[model samples]
Target: MKVVIFETDAPLPIARAKHGSYGDMFKALLQRAPSFATAGPVEYIQLHIHADKPDGDVRDFPPLEDVDAIIITGSRSNAYDTHIPWINQLTDYVKHALAEESKTRVVGICFGHQIIGRALDLQVGPNPAGWELSLTEMALTSEGETHLTTAAKEDNKLALMQFHRDIVFPPLPENVTTLAQTDVCAVQGMHRPRKLWSVQGHPEFDTEIERELLEYAAGTGMDRKIIDAAIAKLENQETRVERDRAAVADAMAAFLLE
Candidate 1:
């Protein structure tokens, strides 16, 4: 399997915060994909772009056609930031990926989801009231239950590790369809035609990272009581690391084989 990973500034060797480390998550994801280790030599590439290295320097990278699947991760930067240097290139990358004829699969997580939507003609902006942190419920829309279930291992809710400030609200592309939505956020999960998929939460984070995120969020401008409640609630939430890793690996494997 050929997988291309787009890293959004967080888990690089040099980082301001240690909570968003994804290198371990990527290894875990590969291990979770039952076919990954045993499959005919899996190829995984990491694409880095962050505040420290805004240039993104894709000059040494291989041609896009060599990739069979793409995974774009979230960043601390906002998708609507017109001043960000890499924003345009990132948007173009999404548009090009979606427009490819080789059935190239793309998976966007968090900032990746928002940027992909914007590239596909959707408007991405702040939540106005702010964003949801920690674990929250994403009540599946009827459509969500049908198609999104393909990624689920069993019949139950999929609670992901979420940390975002911007939300997506514009209409999806003609070829796209909604798979899930929460009371506060629509398009929590979406699929493009049949090969591409994206989710607004983080399925790559482990238990330690999740806890770190919750603690960090609690200290922000959030109300003391509300933050306390969220932290308390997080204590009872399901870790689902194993389940999520399996689901993501399954989805990626299926996309590649198809």
Candidate 2:
């Protein structure tokens, strides 16, 4: 399979040193696909959100015919930021790609999730309840179960890592389907038939990455109370839950390939 990954933000220095860029982390996540071992080989191309070009066909992204899927990586930057030129450029690209492309698939995470919402003309803004950090347990709608179960080994609630303050709200486009939700974010995940899939949490993130993120967020003025509570969840093994990361990856793989 061939994929292009768009890295939206630079990772914290420590995390980047250990995990490489956000695009690289996604490259690693591709292995979680159920067919990876038998799929022969995969091709991946990386692009930064900052690298967008104006020309359509020969712009930042490869032609849709050349790629099977496009995945947008998580970013520390807010998705609703209109002040940033690259942010607007990326959103416009997504808006056009979603409307014009039919053969290729798209997946978005966190800020990327919000990007899809913005592209679709949905409400994208900060959550009134504030930031969501650490592993968040989320529920899948019946439609979600039907779609995601095709790619999952077993069916159950999802527990994925989250580190975002922004949320994607209602008035979804005609093609969009609400897949999963949690207490803080109603749009935890969404699907658009064979074309697009997106989520507000990080399936590629682990506890260690969250640890690094918590500190980094604090340095940027995120409240310590929120970070401390999230930290406790990571430290308390008794209540700790393993994320259904592989299951999500499996679903994404099936979505991109099918």
Candidate 3:
């Protein structure tokens, strides 16, 4: 299968040194799925939306009909920020892609999730509860239990890696069903039938990358207490990373192959 990744941001220098680019991280995460492992060969095309060409404009993206599936990567840029023309263009591109075809499945992670929410006219902005950093426990909704192939079937709750200050607030768009949620963020995962699927957490994140991120955040002079808490949470929940990665990858594979 052919997949196009819309990369909105590059990884921090510290993290990038260890894990490579965000596109590489996502490719590694998705390849962990058993289905993807045996699905013959898969081709991935990465489009960096954060960069502008010599013409001082973001490069035009390929049409939705040209690929089997699309995955939008997390970004530091806020979806609601109109100052960034590329962000607005990317949001419009997502809306246009979904509107043009129903067969192309799209998955959004973190900033990507908020972008899709904004594209659908849902309220996407900062969370009143503040940043949801490090590892977090998310409970599956009834729809999640019944419809989500990504969740652990035997367990109602799953631990996922999260790093976001923004959220996709209710009421969700028509036909959209929330799959999972946490106390801090009401919309952790959502599916809009055959068109789109999105999750607030970072399935592509691993312990090492998160550690680098924490260090990077510390260098930024963010609150030391927040960094320490994130470190503690990361250390405590490190074991669950592999399990969550496999579950999410399986779900993504299923969505793409469906």
Candidate 4:
């Protein structure tokens, strides 16, 4: 399968050294699924959206039919910020892809999730409850039970890794369905039939990378209490980090294949 990774931003220097790029982490995580063992060869194409600063443009996006799926990565930027020209460009591309008759599947993660919500005319912005970091338990809705066909099916509540402050608010698009929810965010996951699938958590993040990210956030002047909480949560054995990572990967792989 030909998969296009729409990379929104690069990892911090320290984190990148330890975990590689987000695209690299995603490739490793997706390959963990047993189905990938016999799914034949898969090709990944990384299209870095923020690489060339002043000249960046989404008009150069590849034709929809050329790839089987498109996965948009989490970004440090906010989706609701129209001041950033690239955010608008990326949102436009997503809208165009979803509106097209082609069958290309689109999966959005974190910032990507917010971007899709905005593209579909849903409210997406800062969360009133602040950032949800580390491992968080998200309860699956009836729609999730009916639509999700991977590791997420094993239980009603799945603990997945998350690191974001933005959220998709209420009054969702007419065609969208909420799949999962947490106390902090109402839209932990969502599906729009065959066109789009998105999650507010980061399936690509493992304990080690999250630890590095926490340290990075700390150095960046984030609240000390938030960073300490994330650190303590990461150290907590009850988080079951590995299991959550696998569950999200399995669900993501299944969705893309479907």
> Which window of ten consecutive residues has the lowest lDDT sum in model 4?
50-59
> lDDT tens digits, residues 60-145, model 3?
77776777778898887788886677888878878876784456678899988988898888898899899898888888899766
Give a tens-digit lDDT track for model 1, residues 147-257.
Answer: 435345255456666778788884776777776677778778777654677778877765556666556656676567766665665674454544654565665455455
| Cα RMSD (angstroms) for every candidate in the order listed | 3.6, 3.7, 2.4, 2.4
lDDT for each candidate structure? 0.67, 0.77, 0.80, 0.81
Shift of residue 67 alpha carbon in model 1, Å = 1.6
Task: State the displacement of the C-alpha of residue 191, model 3, in Å, after optimal TM-score superposition.
Answer: 0.9
TM-score of each: 0.82, 0.87, 0.91, 0.90
In the range 1-258, model 2's lDDT, one tens digit per residue, is 778898877777888899898998887776767576467777888886642332221245577777777888887677887777677877887776687645677899998889889988888998999888888877888767765553332544777788888999976777788888888788898898778899889988878888898988788897888888898877753223333676677777767766
Which sequence of candidate numbers ranks them by lDDT, best first? 4, 3, 2, 1
Provide the global lDDT of candidate 3 against the true structure.
0.80
Question: How far in Å is the alpha carbon of 197 misplaced in model 2?
Answer: 0.5
The parts of candidate 4 lying over 4 Å away from their true place are 51-59, 146-155
User: TM-score: which is higher, 1 or 4?
Assistant: 4
**Pairs clashing in candidate 4?**
none
Candidate 3 segments exceeding 4 Å error: 51-57, 100-102, 146-155
Model 2, residue pairs in steric clash: none
Writing each residue's lDDT as its tens digit, candidate 4 over 19-45 gives 788888888888988776468899899
Which predicted model would earn the best TM-score? 3
Q: Give the better candidate number (1 or 3) by TM-score.
A: 3
Please give the ranking of all candidate structures by TM-score, highest first, separated by commas: 3, 4, 2, 1
